[model samples]
Target: MDREQHVHTIDTPKARIQAPAFACDSHIHIYDRRFAASPGNGAHIVDRATVEDYRRVQERTGTQRTVIVTPRPYGTDNCVTVDAIRQLGIDNARGVAVLRPDVSDTELDMLDRGGIRGIRFTLYTPHQAVVTFDMVEPLARRIAELGWHVQLHWTADQIVEHEALLTRLPCKMVFDHLARLPPPVGTSHPAYGVVRRLAASGRVWVKLSGAYLDSQVGLAGGYADLAETTRAWAALLPQRTVWGSDWPHVTETHKPDTAAIFDLLGTWVEDEAARKRILVDNPAELYGFAR
Candidate 1:
């Protein structure tokens, strides 16, 4: 693992920290127009972020494993993410899909066989979310039988507001983008307490990615302002945390430097072992990747 290895990325330079062998980028999205959005898809932009493009992202970040999350624009159509996993090789990639409550048992089994490891709820924007919050509990119950977790992309207020409903979910939880914590440092937010309580109870996982999404500073001073959010979670639950690239960032007017983005974990947790736990071990266990 050469620390100075020359790896290419879409908008950023090569990651300064050399990722350990079996390192995994636990969150990303693959969008291909050929897959076609489902009827449930809301009014949203569709982009061509194919599986081939993510291969270069893997190279740039020095990661060999990935967890491809079905983006909201596709609604309940998880074919794009599933296709990406197949193309990337199931041994190296897994998926977190979005599903309607009426999804049949056969469909769930098929997704399980195809390497889908979890279900995602994108509730941050209620107006655009096809799979609404009420659908979460029932789907979470269904997915739990398959040993899959429920990943959420909820706003800070949403998390606090739904604490009761969330607490009752049968499956484990992984919150996306630092659990979408309120910006300018997330510790003060009430959602922080909710996540911390859930995390302490052993049913929660938080991803230390997508700082630019909430940061008002906007990658200022190398995302220094976002460090508090990252460190707060990393320090609180090292085992229940993972890192991601959130590749082909669709919502952003300016895409982030994923390599530089990956390097921030290096700064947050100087311990090589701790970083490996977040980048390798925890995701392998959570996503059921082979050890």
Candidate 2:
């Protein structure tokens, strides 16, 4: 393998919006070269963004808690994520791991001790994925006993197609990037209705992250379309919504100002109480952070 190139920097302004006490970022990844990417995995480690690197993001955005997610590059090997959770300390951090159904209970117990609260199904893979749709239900059933949820990264159409499956999960569910809705159609897309329905189910949480990825207008335009979608989703399910920085902005052509993204939440949820619900209260409930 060749030397990996670094991705975006953590260059961001001091967040203008002051985060409430125990504010959680709720989504992030710490990619280390020590945990090599799977040979078959399409997503490679373009950077060595560590737990320390992401603390800079947290500092810039005034987020005190974080959810460390296992990136697709490492496939089902969750060592990087687990190590990060350990490094960040379980008291202020939780994690989502990419694991298969065959993982032993003992390993899961260790992961739980390391602050893992969910399993991620990276279904949007260009190549063969380690964890597939067929694996979700069985794994969900197993992790449900451990009180873990299923975190899914699916496109809007796939979310619609698997709505029943998502609803049937024994544990709670999280939809990444607000189902990665089509930028052109925004909430008008048929899948947006399905996502709303899922949110209404009270078992699903939509991550108000990744505005940079979902924006059709590019990063320079400040992801106006995504901001609109966030406002709509927040109005419909304030309790079910949580925000993330998606720090290091992997695979993105242009890196967004994370502080700007944090401030955008203030615009979406104008009321201070409602903003607290989205940023502090909701994440506390979802990730088991102390209230």
Candidate 3:
């Protein structure tokens, strides 16, 4: 089987959604086989999705800015993501890297200069993490000095459990995948309230990404079940919200059409200005894009 076939194809019907200028896809991963998977990383690494391949996605989604994240496959070796940032150009790209607690200040500085704006703690993946929840507060303290934030991918319950720690972190917080909260429980979940309150603190941001991950209604419905929750967050915290396609849709049994994902944003954020805030202004401030 061709490895390239495993990556998502951009063939959805023309999206009703159109992105505003400087629209940013705030979450994505680039998997290059040259970057060896970490030991004990049980996660299945996918085919190489290079900078150019993602540009095709940009063409389809009409998003010019992106945040290239280092997935668990690369462990703490962020060569592929750092390289992608450089190729995509510092002005249009930012990155979220994964690093060990013992990483040197010199190395951190180098990554900071390489367009990395935050460190990720991906608790939702099957693989063992190089940085766990317990390490977040301490690491946030160190990165806070450099004006870097902490990005997290955790289950909804864990968000509630770690609410205090999240609030106490010295730097800003970004929650991936709508906080990964399940439906029916959805915003009624206790963690959702905590997340809302944290966003109120003016230091927390949430990515409108990974709709299928938490959708009880599944992909056939285009994850429409999440629309209400998505609208609540957008209306309540437009300035703190951003959109991401979760491109490659690696976790799903089947890949979702990226164009459809862009279209979904229209249902969630109907007001043109509010949609621009999620796609443009919020990401610009959170990721330090030049005006």
Candidate 4:
């Protein structure tokens, strides 16, 4: 989509429930205008999602902190996300960056100083090359030295195939969008079993976000089963599970309604204690959110 087409102001719904202090939106993208001029192949251009925009969402949603994730459009140039963290102030935010395997230690140190806590490798989109097992080892070692985690976006089906490699990584592994599992199949699906087992490892964490992307029934029915699946995963690893809005919902023709996404969490984890862990405690611990 063109940058202009993605720039329209969206009316975010008022959060229906009060969010706890230290609450965090662990995943969102901030595209800058410069990325469009210097785009990568198959890149999806988007309007700049500035720090001001995030502040407004936080004000409305009671989100006290956020994790700015670098989008593919930026193509490993994490300037947009890094700049947003600096502009927003590091005390209230952290970031996940996209970096080439060969990025120097100096650059990685600079990123850590800029509030980056993780390195994300994408495997969901065909446009982005699939990351291999070989890549995982060295990358994991480097990130582990920095005390940063590795955030992976992959299809559920690929988990079993890559299980041994992923399990052996020295760094903490975060699975985005509940391992990007396909919905309508429910938690009983074999792939989710792999997710459960992965979570049981203590080193693997899962984001209870992006159900709309994986579900077959749009937002409504899609979220119900997705919540069921999340509950199962949460039961397996409550301390390791976290939640995020996946705000802006890029690429989808109809953007995911933000309020609807947050409200769905209530259904996913009905127990207040579990919800607290996913929304507050877990993120604070995983992302190293300063109290």
Task: Report, for every candidate in turn, its global Cα lDDT versus the true structure.
Answer: 0.84, 0.82, 0.84, 0.77
- Give the clashing pairs for model 1: none
Off by over 4 Å in 1: 1-12, 39-48
Model 1: how far is 39 from its true place, Å? 4.6
Model 2, which residues run further than 4 Å from truth? 1-12, 126-128
Per-prediction TM-score to the true structure, in the order listed: 0.93, 0.92, 0.93, 0.90
Model 3 scores worst on lDDT over the 10 consecutive residues at 1-10
* Model 4 lDDT on a 0 to 1 scale: 0.77
Candidate 4 C-alpha lDDT tens digits along 21-51: 8788899888777545245456666654667
Ten residues in a row with the worst lDDT in model 2? 1-10
Tens digit per residue, CA lDDT, model 2, 45-153:
8564788777766777788889999988888888899888888888889999999878998999999988999999878752556778989999999999888899988
RMSD of 4: 3.1
Q: Give me the runs in candidate 3 sitting further than 4 Å from their true place.
A: 1-14, 125-127
Candidate 1 structure quality by residue, lDDT tens digits, 1-291? 222122242444668999999999998888787877666555454444677767777778899999999876677878888888899999999999989899999999999999999998888887877778999999999999899999999998899999999899989999989887766747899999998888767989998888878877785567677788888898898898999988766666666667777888889888999999999899988999888
In model 4, the runs with Cα more than 4 Å from the true position are 1-12, 34-38, 130-133, 220-222
Model 3: number of clashes? 0
